[model samples]
Target: MTNEPTIRSIIEQELERRGYSLSSFASRSGINRGTLSAILNGNPPKPIAIRQLDLMTEALEQPEGHFYPLYVNECVDSDQPNRRRVKAFLLRCAEVGQTECIQEVLDRIVENLSYIPMIFEIGEELYEKGLREESRLFYNVVIESEKYQHSERLAISHYRLFRLSLGDDAEANLIAATRFELYLYRLPEDYQLDGLLHLANAYLTLQKWVQTEIYSDELRNLAKMVYKNYERAYLQGKAFQFRAERNLVVYYGQGYVLKGIALQFQRRYEEIPEYIAGYADLSWFVGLNESGKEEVEKFKLFAKLNTYNLKVLLGDQSIIPEYIESVKKHPPEILPSLRVIVEASNIHNFFIDDILEQFNIDTGLYDRADNYYRLEVSKDRYLRLFYHLSVYYLRKKEFEEGISKILITLKIAISLKNYNYFMKLIPLFERYRSFATEGQLKEYETLLEGVIKDA
Candidate 1:
């Protein structure tokens, strides 16, 4: 059997070759001779910190990071690995962008299988510090090496990977969200609430109303169960057993709001009233703490806003003036309300020229790559609103403005890689092709060509 060289032996050989005594080596490496002696000669030699180990390797005329392989013996590959030393060393490897070193440590440690909990903790710490790329390495390691399929750590690792993977591509985001959704129920209640909500919203963004309804239904049920748990504890004058990422009210309210929106998109407008009434007034939702009460107030605002919204969607032209006034009172309500108003105008053949004109320039400025609003409205919502506006303008023979909106929506749909929006956009543009200028036609063809390449 071939034996691996130890750090002590490596230092001894280097010392003999260089003819440097401990005192001389200490002076060169800027470490105390006693500390060096303890590391090299103690009955069970002391653990060397990575910083000191790097210094010793440098004094031996070694290349940068050349000593990392030898140092893994000090961190792991022992009966009892030094956990503190291992964590610090791994973090330093990440900080210095030494991905290979991180992988090396992970490969050695995973053979034992007990290091996954520590690995997961390192992943969390790295994620919280905004080192997403480095954090991804740790989380992926946990996912691949963890032996227990149903463990919470495995679920959390999946969640972290999903979060880090989100980007500008709506198609990729949906893939990630679905992958993470499989593990959502494995999470603790607190995490499940957040995960299910995001999963539902992701489907909504991709215009998958059926999947949106499914997950949103899950969220509503889970949120109600959690509320009852809290309510029961409150009645008993005992502390609740759990907490969630947001106030309980947010989960409860958003569950209904999201499901309602999904149903509205599918034109199941009759079924939405029940969902709307779910959060319409939470004054009766018991046992709210101060933050929970704040969430309740926000739900009340949503209740009023969505009520006007529902009316307009049901083709109530009389409510347009009142809805416009309500939207004006709340800045965040404008985008969604505008979407409803524009779509309703097309449906009911009403005029909203003043409202459209008011927000035209600002709405027209949406970049294909980024979210224009500073609020909670997502890129998907913007894409929908922009498309419907194009339809409305085209119907009115406002080709210049209508074609402009089509091109804007086309750019956004391409950036998102959302095939559903592409389907809608291609048909709408084709119907109005005679009205488009040469440049706009060229841009549309180019965008479709890119989609073919991507496919």
Candidate 2:
């Protein structure tokens, strides 16, 4: 059977069907219009009081069961005190961005220590408001609370979200790396490998290559230990191969990148090739080489090939067109991956118009392709592409086009719920909005409102 209609969606549809504006419905139900609007259109509402649901239901002439079922489940399925209250408080905070209200709700959770997930949920909203300091403090409180049992896995998961929210802050990276290390050490042997991988990544973010190397080595050993344990599955061989490939791509390739960065920082040019070679070998092993043994090498090669074009600008001769030429001669079947490699390698510098012409790619297709790559790869890439495109259009005096692209980029960044990206894009938007029309300006305002409310 299908799930019940969401209370908020139901209210929204019912209000629309009844030809009542939000203001009219608010007056009839005696619910605050702003609060009601937020509940219906913003983040999920906190568990509502039965009486409040009853009032909303009675006023709308709808069955109370529709609105109260979820609330009843919250009460009966758990022993946690004030779960309903905490949920309500969180929803309200999300709607209004009221830090004080949010803090009060969080304070109650801290006092009881029963709703740990709710704390993380609220922390995400706080992060949206650019309140990293407050979010970090709350995360720590949740971590320390005795009432809620914390697990390394949960902490690591939450830390990933926290990292995304805070961007690349060195202090935050250090803290995450430290926590991951402690978690891995304390974790049971059978469960420690995943934690080690996370720890290694955190270290990589902090540019602590030595620490990352240690964790990566541990993870590699752990993977070897688990390799023979799963042999009976129907696709066991393929699954094992896939897992091994993931390790090679993530640990070996990524580790080499870190090592290269570390070597560069230390001015150890003599050792750079070894790290770069490791990176290149792994990339080729993962099918980044066109003549690789894999039948579908093209897709893998394009997807995995790293570009050192930036290195060229820095006077590094490590990445050369001859390497790419070798791949193109024995091209893989994956056209998209090929395109990705071409774009990523900054091959655009040599053949921007030619690549566009050869592919017969329309502007829309180019935009979509760029979006797909950015989404699949990294937000930094997304931002970089958007910035490039915006500047291109702006220089050509296509102000509207530039502003539209930036606005879309901003919306995407906000939707990913990454505050760093949002923060980076906001000022750009504000500066360019002057070129927008009245309707476009209003639309931008509406989008911002939605982001703020949902955030």
Error of 2 at 150 (Å): 7.4
TM-score of 2: 0.41
**Model 2: lDDT of residue 161:** 42
lDDT of 2 by residue, 223-276 (tens): 544533433332354443232223333443444554554454354556666655
lDDT of 2: 0.52
Instruction: Estimate the TM-score of every prediction.
Output: 0.82, 0.41
Compared with the true structure, all predictions reach lDDT values of 0.82, 0.52
Clashing pairs in 2: 46-87, 288-301, 298-332
lDDT, candidate 1, 209-274, per-residue tens: 999999889999998998888888889999776645678888888899899989989888889889
Clashing residue pairs in candidate 1, if any? none
Summing lDDT over every window of 10 consecutive residues in candidate 1, give the lowest-scoring window: 368-377
